[model samples]
Target: MDKFVTRSRAPVEEQEVELGNLPADPGLRIPISDYHPNLKDKVRRAYLQKGACQPSHNFKKRKIENLLRRFNLNWFNEYKLWLEYSVEKEAAFCLYCYLFKSDNKQSGDAFVKEGFDAWNKKERLDLHVGGPNSGHNQARRKCEDLMKQNQHIDVTLNRHSEQIKNEYRIRLGASVDCLRFLLRQGIALRGHDESDGSINQGNFLEILKFLAAHNKEIDGVVGKNAPGNLKISSPDIQHDIVNASAVETLNYIIHDLGDDLFAILIDESRDISVKEQMIVILRYVDKRGHVIERFIGIAHVPNTNAASLKVCIDSLFAKHGLSISRIRGQGYDGASNMRGEFNGLKSLIMRENESAHYIHCFAHQLQLTLVAIAKNNVHVGSLFNMIANLVNVVGASCKRRDILRDRQAIHIYEALAIGELASGHGLNQETTLKRAGDTRWGSHYGTLLSLINMFESVIDVLDTIVDDGPSSEQRAEASALLEFVQSFDFVYSLHLMKNVLGITNELSISLQRKDQDIVNAMKLVKLSKLRIQMLRDDGWDDLLAEVSMFCEKFNIICPNMEDNFQMKGRSRRKVHQVTNIHYYKVEFFYGVLDMQLQELNTRFNESNMELLLCMSCLSPNDAFAAFDKKKLIRLAQFYPNDFSSVELMMLGNQLGTYIFDMRSDNEFLILNGIAVLAEKLVQTKKDMVYPLIYLLIKLALILPVSTASVERAFSAMKIVKSRLRNRMGDQLLNDSLVTYIEKAVFDGVLNESIIQRFQHMKNRRGQL
Candidate 1:
């Protein structure tokens, strides 16, 4: 309550004194000016309540020029209220002057800053309490006024403004309600026209109007009824409220993080206005042991170079009171500027803290691996290029698209009449050919499936274009695409990639999930590799038979499997002779599958695989079936600072006991993962009993598995900084994003807290 009201006294004019904790020795006491301005009055009251620090000790005698002189404790009786003695300095001081001394030079200075100790001069004490207007008398008057609490300036100012404060609260609450709605929805507040006569002012002002019209209390103190200068609806005031909300949300995130180690996931992209903004997310296990990833901030950098990014990250950490040494992991894309071995952002962070392990984003790596291996093969590359041309030529306009749909409808109805195709609730739906994205490998699978379903319809559209042409160029292009679609190489590559991407598609989607853990994700990786390896070893005959069946159904000639195969554009006399089995099965079929397998193995190598396998040992799945004491001990060795040699020896013993205790206990049986096990340990008070094991759990959770959280923030950036609001300043952009992304934290923030924060930011016209 006291913090809500502004202080009336200047900081330099007030003094602080702690009563129960006051220093009895005047020599060790601090100056009153050194205390915080808000606590000054409390300090003064504390000292007055204790009533001075006069300790009655036996007087010690000192010989001066053969004459014995000793300080008399009887002087306390003469000046009982102000006189005090210090055992440390053997000094007598005036308590009133010590607490309320002025800044000007005064004759009673010896009683305050210097701690008076001249006991031989018996008359000097009388002279210190000079006249009524003396410094001693003035200090005495101040002490008396301080003891009367009502005489304080802050109380007097606050008492007269009771009604105004209530009105301000109502007004501020209304403004905050509007702000919360607009921010949570990521809607822009300002409009193109915002004059009074305009139909729609904006989201902020219009929402405030709607709110005021319904709530009588808000209507009384807002808009025209409120004081002109105190209106809280201006653009600057709105920005202040937004800034406060962002600060509060960020504070909550940091507080929830506590002193726990955390990993950082960072990524950068251009906004609508072409500004390069970097979004940072923190991944850590919370008190409930849930893996929480919070979007902390977005920084606008001059460029995306590694050194500039490091500087920006360092500044952000310093501003938030976070230390670089607490970083245990870093996740980023596979760009050279991000994950390069030297001079990259990850490398720079690793140089400072060796424990901050770098992990390339698994999802992005899979995409790059698939795209790289596909382009490396000649037949697959030509097949994809032909697919792209087929989609463009067949579905170039509405007329061609209608033809495609009609022809496909005929094929579907004819097949259903003969029972060649099965009918169901969602079968035979219309779909157009899709273009495969360079960065999205799953889209290629969809494109191939669409091509297979509409193969006859695509050929019909191309034949129509050849007969009734838009021009000669269009006719020639459609004729050439028609020939390629009817060839064996095109049909074979289409089916080959369709089967291959189908295997990896499930793994790609699994890696992008927010709840994915390193152990499960690595397992999915291994399984995908196995499936691809099996396809390479035993899938050639099945693939060739499927292609042959498709060619026969479409009237395309299937080459004899035992005949000598020649290159497409070369003569058999000049080219190397090879059987169809050697060319199709040995060269093309094995080539693509081998490339995919090699890429997967190279990208996800054995060393990191071993680390993830060791981490999997901590999983609580199947009632702690995966728990291995030796592997857990080895995991602890990765973080040397967290566990020393002595702690490691104790940890080995603790792990042996921990596994048995967990397996025997009924409470631990319901736990599913290491995260849940962490929370249960805290709930049962075992975290304290087995402290080293809990520490290891925290360290394991700090290792990041994906950068999906950062990617989600970039998705939010598109909504918050759309083209219409492209010119928004960087500070406003960052503030709005923080509140928008962490709405749960913002919703818990009280409206009064935002008002207090807004008031403290500067001198507001309204008294809040």
Candidate 2:
């Protein structure tokens, strides 16, 4: 009886038994041993309560040696208690042996397993009831003992054991609940001192204590009352919970992905421990037609070479039940190993799947374009170098920074009092000089804007440094920066680049958006080119006027436009005589803008343009006004695997009806983007009506415009594996980050599922 049930079971009275629902036919009923371990006892007791299933109906007859013989209902009188009949099988079964027979014992063979219906064999029943040591007699004794449940000692011990199992469940559930909260919020679970009596025993323990304090049942079983080995609060247990949560989260993501094709956005960076880790994001259209980007995993790579990354990617895909052929797009940075011609990751994948188009991250490309064009010009390059030195000189020390802030405040107050500056909440806020970074051109634009606003304060700080003489080198540096700030060329270059960056900044930001499509992105690119060209053509006079005004305000001399242009550090007589207008307008303004336009053109070239244009033909904007039959057909030809020659021809016919049907409907008239159009199609069930067009839409959405999602995963990696947690192992880091980054998806995973996953991970001291 002690090992009768291997799993926890309910108390006898609490167990439910619906006799009307039980199967009376022995052949159709589930075997007692086949029930869940926890339900075996309950099933046995239910069957005993219902008694035998002998029917009084007429029995079917069989011919045995020219004599008619049939099952006799009167046999129930001879084998009174144990005989049961199966209406479905028309056989007699032994009730005692069926209920109490051990899985390995087979003493009453025909009666237990095959069912006996031999009406002429009267002595077989007597023989089956053999001796006291026989399997059938032993099963009968056990059955008889089970029916006498009035034993006080056995009942009390069973109830107590059941209570212990219930308490163990509550204790483990509380631990899992705490871990879920911590994991969702990306909070670290452990502390340096998690020992008892420590005030901060970590998020896990403290949260568990807080939960127990509010619930009487949890309070009763958690601390002193719980078994020492089953407390479930150790670091290993926390890791188990965390790992379970991550696995469940990944499962949910993959389930949402379904069988749809997805693009992989990958990027690699070194963590706080200098470990090279690559993060992957899956971009796919969900069932609802929303373009979703989910961070799947991060892998530790020994090196960032092409072959190593390829192996790592293949392993990750295999581990997740993902296929390499399903990848329709690959997005990476401008590194050679990622996009190299012969041996790159993209090329390798392309050899397997030619349609997996490789696209460099648009945001990174724009940054490079800005950096290349700006440095290519001598004036703009020197201007930036001076700006960097000026910011460093002014904000180098706390004393200098303080002076700059105080001076800016004074200037703002004076200007407000004199009505020269407007005062508003969020206007004229305290800001310091931003140092530009080499990798991010956006930072340079930010630095320029901040310098323009804090120009006077910066000059005041430098002037103070020059006069205070902290050191001769510092003073000389300060003096040199001060001279550069006062020159007409410096101010002109600063304003000129600011205007150029201002135009491209909007496009850069637009391309980085997760929802941006290739059509609108290309349109923005063309628009940016036009604006920069306009600036080159007609912006010279306005720019000159603004720079001159800035110079005049700062008490710097402004040169007359009609005067002869003079090169700095060169004699006026030795310099070529050129009007100041020609030098400032042509040599400087037009030159820099032309270089920017050329870089933009070179980066977003003819091939990229053609591809994007064809994709744009599928846009739902203007009621599918941009839709073209030829271009969309061409788009389908790009993914030959998705659409064959026959489907392509069918698609051409479907497009004719698809566009006409969409245009005629009011609901589709207001559709704005490809994503919205896709969702509308699904809602109206038009996706089924035009399967080919919908496939093309999914392909367009799968073509990633930027690697922003992967970049964000790297950002989360830094936070999860910071300097303090630098020693975290690879598996732990990967688990923590997946749950942290994809919290939205993780939140949908139930706590029960995570507990079950954890329990099934391995045997635990307590059942969850």
Candidate 3:
């Protein structure tokens, strides 16, 4: 009673009551037979939009063969498009006709207008499908067509695909053939006159025409015979093909590099347009175990400062999906801007990756060694200046060049008559004085050697200059030059420096060689230093005697060794003189020789020697003499992150086992480089066995030997973006150079792959 009284506030009105029928949910409604065309289509459209509603629980069932078998879901699966069943009617229906049948057309009402309930007469499903052109089949076709557009495999070929592909092949093949021909020949692509009336339009166009004229197949598919838009020899098309070749070549280079660590040989210069450009070459061990230096890219920058250059480099790595972490070393000319201690490009890279050690270009270092030693003493410096002046004066005009040559011939004839000289194929070839450049390797040697070979000829030329110069002033200058050159002082200095540079000239050339390894280079450096020391100690008397003999043969005056020493230039001073032996032996000879020794020692000092020694342990050459386990463990200290306490401890034992195994392993025995060694290890499934040792090998292999590759690339940049093509964009020039420099790789690329890449760039009327 108490509960009733408490809850008695509201009676019947408290609860809501339903009074009228509500509209049915479209999702729950069943398909009906023979409804108005518009109404059925409206429901069909809604069903199509909402998708199939074949609820599992709502499926009807019937007894068959004394078994309570339900309507098989397989039926709905097999005829999913046309066979839809209804829960409301407990019957089957046809979706195809329901949505697509016309109002005028009357069909069997079993499955469409009227829901079919005769499960025993399931054969009518086949009747419902009817003939190919029947209303049911037509409705089925419409449904199939509606779903076909949803298939994402839209890039498949159509019926005309083969025809289009063939035409594209012919057009592209002709163009590629022409372009490859031009690329192989290293000929220019365009001409000043490209007009149709011109005979030689360009290498590209003319080569294409030549191929077309030669081959009927090519003739039918290129240039004027091709579709206007499909003319594959257009500048843009030519460029695309070139770029394709470049991309393919780069892909191969990347594939060869794989995930192994690599170094960057970096150098910068102004392009033909005077734009600052950084040429980057990847120095890495290739699959063949060869230390390959590949031209990776040429990046154009606003300035050559460290920050700007770093930005450009970072951008390039990112663009190519490369990681700076992979850089084990960097090579560049030792400009303060590049090698600055605090904020140079090397410092910036090393900050990001500590292992990216900076190496001054060894080739450049050798050049600087020459300059530093030459400039360290005034006497040696004066000698170089005089030689340069002599070369310039003698090689100025071809007329003068002929005069010098004729003089050389006459001198050779006299020397031959007197049996003073021997003639040979390579020995007596027409010789010209080479201009000595600060950057040119072996230049000083060349100049000195040429002057010595043509000594009498040079003297004869100077004598003629003294007698028959254009003016008296010229004659006087020539006369003085002749006298100075003929003196014993000039010849002594000449032979002195010549002997010194001669010791290092081979080392310089070897350092610049493409296949030079750090181990070999380091050995060469030591050998050069040893030879220089030996020359300094034992070379004085021999050089003096040689100079004296040369003077006697050339009719130049020879000074007595006992005479008082006098400097070359005129200066008013007291007669506080020294003996000629004291001057030449103590002052001049020791002066130049000691300075060169000091420069070499300083440049290739202890730290450098240590690095090279540590690096030499990675040399796979010479039966792996440089591949020492103990020294390698020491080298592992350089990269602490890759090889820590555990790795370093295991590396020693693993290396011994690897070397022992490698000797018997034919593949390993034949392996010659860090690159090939790494590959062979992987191929033989031994990479993981001696991974720490291999890591060390990879590090050493990637350590830069020189920046000659980068320098060559910059030199090529000058040729690619010449004054005539100065306006060429950076990207265009890069693409052209990649193909030009790596022509071997580019040539190896199949025409089909390049054409396919071109086709996929954009949809065209014809497939490429």
TM-score leader: 2
Residue 561 lDDT (model 1): 81
- Identify the leading candidate in terms of lDDT: 2
Which ten residues in a row are the worst by lDDT in model 3? 17-26
In candidate 1, which residue ranges exceed 4 Å CA deviation?
A: 1-164, 213-216, 219-228, 389-432, 453-475, 549-556, 569-574, 606-610, 621-627, 666-673
TM-score of each: 0.75, 0.77, 0.75
Model 3 ranges off by over 4 Å: 1-165, 413-427, 570-576, 606-609, 617-630, 656-688
lDDT of each: 0.79, 0.79, 0.69
Candidate 1 lDDT at 224 equals 82
Q: Name the 10 consecutive residues with the lowest summed lDDT in model 1.
A: 1-10
- What would the TM-score be for candidate 3 when compared with the true structure? 0.75
lDDT (10s digit) by residue, model 3, range 3-100: 11111223322122110010011122323333333344333433453334343332446776665544555786788656765544556777667656
Global lDDT of model 3: 0.69
lDDT (Cα, 0-100) at 502 in candidate 3: 83
Residue-pair clashes per prediction, in order, are: 1, 0, 5
- Residue clash pairs of candidate 3: 33-113, 33-114, 34-113, 289-675, 289-676
Distance (Å) between predicted and true CA of 35, model 3? 53
